[model samples]
Target: MPGRPHLIPGLSAVPPARRLGSSWSRGVVASAAACLVLAGCSSTITIDDHDLSDADRAACEALVADLPGTLAGKDRVGVEPADALGAAWGGRASYVLTCGVPEPEDYEPTAECSVIEGVGWYVPDDQLTDPAEDATPVALSRTPFVEVLVPAEHRTEGIDRALAELAPVLEEHLGEGLSCL
Candidate 1:
C-alpha cells in the first residue's frame, strides 16, 4: 500500500493502483491537497509518447484535433511535448487519453466489451485498478486503438460521459469498424 502514485513522474500520496469494481473509501486520497503537494503536479501531466508509424501518427492527429477541452467536468491540462498525441484533464487525480495505441494482446471474443457511440471498447477485467473512486482505464478495441485512463472518482458515469463526447470524433475520424474481440 504505497501512497505515491506510480505512473506519473511527480505526484505525491496518489494511490499506486486503482482497485476496480471497488469503492474509493479505502483511504486512497480524499482531498486534492494531499495528492497535489508537488510543485508541478497541478500544472502538467506526463505521458510516455508511443513510437507510432506514419499512418498511426496521421490518425492520432485527427483524433487529437477534435479532443474536447474539458472532460468529466475537468479542464484540459497541458502536457510537456505540445505535439504529443495525448490529452490530460484535472490535477493530481486526472483523466489521461492517448491515441494510436496497439491492439490488446489478450483480446477475446468472450471478453467484456462496451459499445458507446458506435465504438467498441474492450474492457480489461484483470488489469482494472480503481486507485481511488473514479480511476478506471478503458481501452478502445480498434487498430491504432485509444486508451483512456480515467480518474478514480468519476467511475463508470464519467467513462460514459467521456465516451459520449469522444465516440463521434473517433468514429468520424478513425472510422467505427471496430468490433468485439
Candidate 2:
C-alpha cells in the first residue's frame, strides 16, 4: 500500500507518465516505422532479364554466381522472373545489379568516374553531389557492361561499399581493364 498509488473508483491516484521529447522513444518509433515499411514490401524483387550474346550471358552467369551472399550489410534476396543476368539485395530499398546491359546514353569519355578497388564506375555528376532516390552507377571499361541501381536511401557511402565488395568478383568473372584515368 505504501509503494502503490491509491486507486479511486474509476481512476488511479497517479496519472500516467508522458515520454515527450524522449530521444530513445523517438528512435524506437523511427525504427519501428522503418521495419513496417520494409515488412510491407515483397521480399522478391523484379529484375528484367537482359538480352545478351552467348559469351556475354556466360560471363554474367558466372558473375551472378560469384556475387557475395551479402552486400552493404543486406542479405541477398530472390529476384522475380529469375535470371542469371540480374541479382538483387535488401527489401523495399533494394540494391539491384544487372549485367550485360548497354552503356548509358549520357556516358562520355569526359564524364566523371570513380575507381573503387581498381574497378572503374561511371557515376553521374548529380549522383556525386545530390543524387535522386534511384540513381544508378554503371561499370566502366568493362565488358558485358554492368550497372547497379542504388536507392538514395542507401546514400553514397553504401553504394561505395557495395561497389567495393563486387569489384573483385567483377574483375574475376568479367576480366579487369577498368580505367577512369
Candidate 3:
C-alpha cells in the first residue's frame, strides 16, 4: 500500500484504472454492478412454494421495524445501522429473516465471504413469554443460510439479492402451527 493510493475498507487497495473521486464511490459502483451475478447464483438457491399467512407477514414487518431503530444507535462499540449495509426482509413464515455479513462459522482468510442466515425464532420471543422480554435471541435455521460469497467490495449487491430470494422461501417453509411473529 505504500507507493499505491489507499482505498476504502471494501474497495480494492490498488487504484482502479478509471478516474474516481474517492475510493468509496468506486467501491459502491463496482459492488452495485455485481447484482448481475445473481443470475448465475440462481442455480444454488432452491425455491419452493412455502405458504405464509397474513398474520405472519404482519408480525414480520412489526419485528423488522424494531430492528432498524434498535440497531442503528450508539452502542459501546459505536453507532451502527439497524440494517446491515445491504440487508432486506425475506423468507417464509415471517420468522425467516436473513442478514448480510460473513457467517461467523464460514469466515476464512481466503474468502471474502458474507452470510445470510434465517432465524427460526428471534430470541426471547422463541423462549421467554412473560409478554415483555427482549425477544431477539433467535434460533438459526434455513439451509446453509450463507448465500454465495463474492468479493467483499461487491458484498452489498450480492447480499441484497440473497435477502430478496429468501423472502419467498418463508411461505414455502411455514408449518401448520408455526409462529414466526
Top candidate (TM-score): 2
Better of 1 and 3 by TM-score: 1
Q: Give the TM-score of candidate 2.
A: 0.71
Write candidate 2's Cα lDDT for 113-180 as tens digits. Answer: 55566567775554444443445667876778887876656654476678778888998899553455
Q: Quick one: best lDDT, which candidate?
A: 2
Off by over 4 Å in 1: 1-40, 127-139, 176-178
Summarize candidate 3's per-residue lDDT along 55-141 as a digit string, tens digits. 544433343344331111111111113332222222111112332222334223342211223223222212222222111111233
Give Cα distance to truth, residue 69, candidate 3, Å.
4.5
2 versus 3: better lDDT goes to = 2
TM-score computed on alpha carbons, candidate 3: 0.21
Q: Which ten residues in a row have the lowest lDDT in candidate 3?
A: 70-79
lDDT of each: 0.58, 0.63, 0.27
